[model samples]
Target: MYESGEVAIPLKDRVFGRYLADDVKTTEGKVIMKNGEYISHEEIETIEKENITSVRIKSPITCGCVNGICAKAYGRDLAKGEPVNTGEAVGIIAAQSIGEPGTQLTMRTFHVGGVASSSAEKSNFESPSDGKIKIQNLRSVVNQAGSEIIINRTTELEIYDLNKKLVSTFRAPYGSTLLVKDKAEVKLNDLLLEWDPYTVPIVAEEIWHFRF
Candidate 1:
């Protein structure tokens, strides 16, 4: 219905008696109209019932020096956002690419206060088997609570059964306090070590109010 030379038009604005430029098919591959078929009121009603918004109509037949095939190829290129002419500058293409909606993602990040990114804090290490505990490479200091807090990173705790066979090995991070002494007997799931998490809890020891 538009006065311009545009081939595709909205289905509501499509001119009756014009020919279909391409085949129109349903989503299930049923042909609604074949290429070059004349569009009449019946065809328009059928297409509208199919919920088609736009349709391509055959362009006016032209004479003279114009190559219809070449014109169609250029039209397809223009529709696809491809450069219509050779030697198009790369900067122009880059600008066009950046202007697309897909390239406009926000760089903003969101974070919740007081939520730690680390995994769940482990406060205690339990013995994995019934065995005697043997400590190695341990350097620790006894706290006021009479707990031996390991200060070294290389400490390895080994568990050996009654036959002196190694049952399991355990390592605790620095600042971990031993719950069982060296050569202490422990059963499976028994407490072997304990430590506070790396992150401290936020506490307000004193309350003060300020008017803003």
Candidate 2:
């Protein structure tokens, strides 16, 4: 269940610093008959003066300094007028005068990746041993026109140990499109495996070429 509170009146936009009591006064001056009993603001004022009962202020009053007192009175008046759903009514009024209404609020959730429980620095080491290997006959063609074209050929290789643990990963440099001859035996700690060759696949090779 929600709670209730005094309404906050905005004073920044008020044209005049003060609000007149006459502006907030009812059309009929405080006296009337209701259910065979005399009902009037005068009677209530009299009771208030005599200290017989508490005086309840009504809202929409244009009394002096409407910023603080008048605003609270307006909220109270609304609450009393609609006691069954005063919470929503008061909220609407408060949002209109004191805060922004109907604005979307957003929140983001993030998830961490990798093996470490906390953030860790990346390692520069590649393999446990050192060896020498070489690739040969590499060629690359670049097609740069308004339409799509193909240029380079490449292959993917993944080397792993007998235990199936990934030892190293390598990609051929751009422009040169043959087996990397000098890149072999570069201290690869595991077995050698190669993937099928990739043919020229799209245009813009000069702009989107792979480096390693």
Candidate 3:
């Protein structure tokens, strides 16, 4: 078993000025004095209270100020050590510490694409208009997306600029047809749908572009 100190002394002996050379331990190797504390009257009292009879002193108990507590001097003399992780909640702290520079991002509008409004009559498809018309409606599928996407008769579309800033949202109005169902793969040239030129199609582009 590990003993308290290297040299044993009787409890009655009063070594007035001394330094604990090594960590004092119980007979079973439990630590007592942590090896560097200045042996002061207070420490002695504590040792006496714990009934520790003797303590080992280093080869030299080399401190001039034995009259008072040497803790301040010992602390100054102590070397700096690497930081220890206390298993703190670092993720929470990091999240909180992050600063948000501006106000809330994103527009208030939301859109659901590929759904035509219910108010549009299917009979509108019977008559043909002179404008260029494209016919397919499919959605671009993402790898992680599910196999099914259900689009009702109404679909909403939110448009954003290249900067990812929200520009506007479009909900399929009356007289529009929904050509694509859920989870369909579509490309840029794929037809979104036939647009009523007299109404919302190029007229929309004209209004946006200020083309009369």
Candidate 4:
């Protein structure tokens, strides 16, 4: 619980019979569940449909004092509590403070002595919107191992709508393995690239013009 008498819990961890500390609303500002209402299984399903990841629930008073004494001391309801401000990113802030230090310490220990270590990196691109991919300036070469490897380093992946209007553009990180072919249609959450993120990132400052 935070100082404001509320705790943010992830949707998956939320328990029934707990009261809400604030109004739960949809992305368009329509209220799904009002403040101080007890969470029910039906409410949980409704929240899931809206894609809400977390919610603030009222924190029960645990001052460990005599029943009426604590209520009088705090000058608030013994059962219900004050609403926590939704503007505060309490969940994200707490996670960074608690998780970053451990992650940094673990990353440092990955490279002990002279051995190269694999660092965590994003190895794939998931499509954010529905569109067709348009690949440009792509160049590759076959290695002695008979594997095709991208070498241009400056190739671009552009997303276009059915009307041929460009919607978004992305540049593949150097040495990334391409997954989708040019003019391939894609939908949301579709995989676009399977990058070699475990290896040291290769950078090329100049654009290449290959003739093959």
Best by lDDT: 1
Q: How many pairs collide in each candidate, listed in order?
A: 0, 15, 7, 0
Q: Candidate 1, after superposition: displacement of residue 33 in Å?
A: 75
Please write out the lDDT profile of model 2 over residues 74-146, one tens digit for every residue: 3323335422232345445667764332332222333446664474332122444444433333344434433
Which regions of candidate 3 fall more than 4 Å away from where they truly are? 1-13, 59-212
Which sections of candidate 4 miss by over 4 Å? 1-120, 142-148, 201-212
RMSD for all candidates, in order, please.
26.9, 29.2, 32.4, 15.1
| Model 4 lDDT, residue 178, Cα | 69
Model 1 C-alpha lDDT per residue in residues 1-212, reported as the tens digit of each score:
21111122455554355556789888788988988676666887998899775677654352122533223222213335432343334346647877644444554444444644454556777887887999999888776677777776677789898778998766666777778888998898998887666543232223456698
* lDDT tens digits, residue span 123-210, model 4: 7677768889998888865445544456765677888877778977666665666677889999987887656655754544355677
lDDT of each: 0.64, 0.34, 0.40, 0.62
Cα lDDT of model 3 overall? 0.40
TM-score of 3: 0.22
Enumerate residue pairs that collide in model 4: none
Ranked by lDDT, top first:
1, 4, 3, 2
TM-score of 4: 0.35
In terms of lDDT, the poorest run of 10 residues in model 2 is 1-10
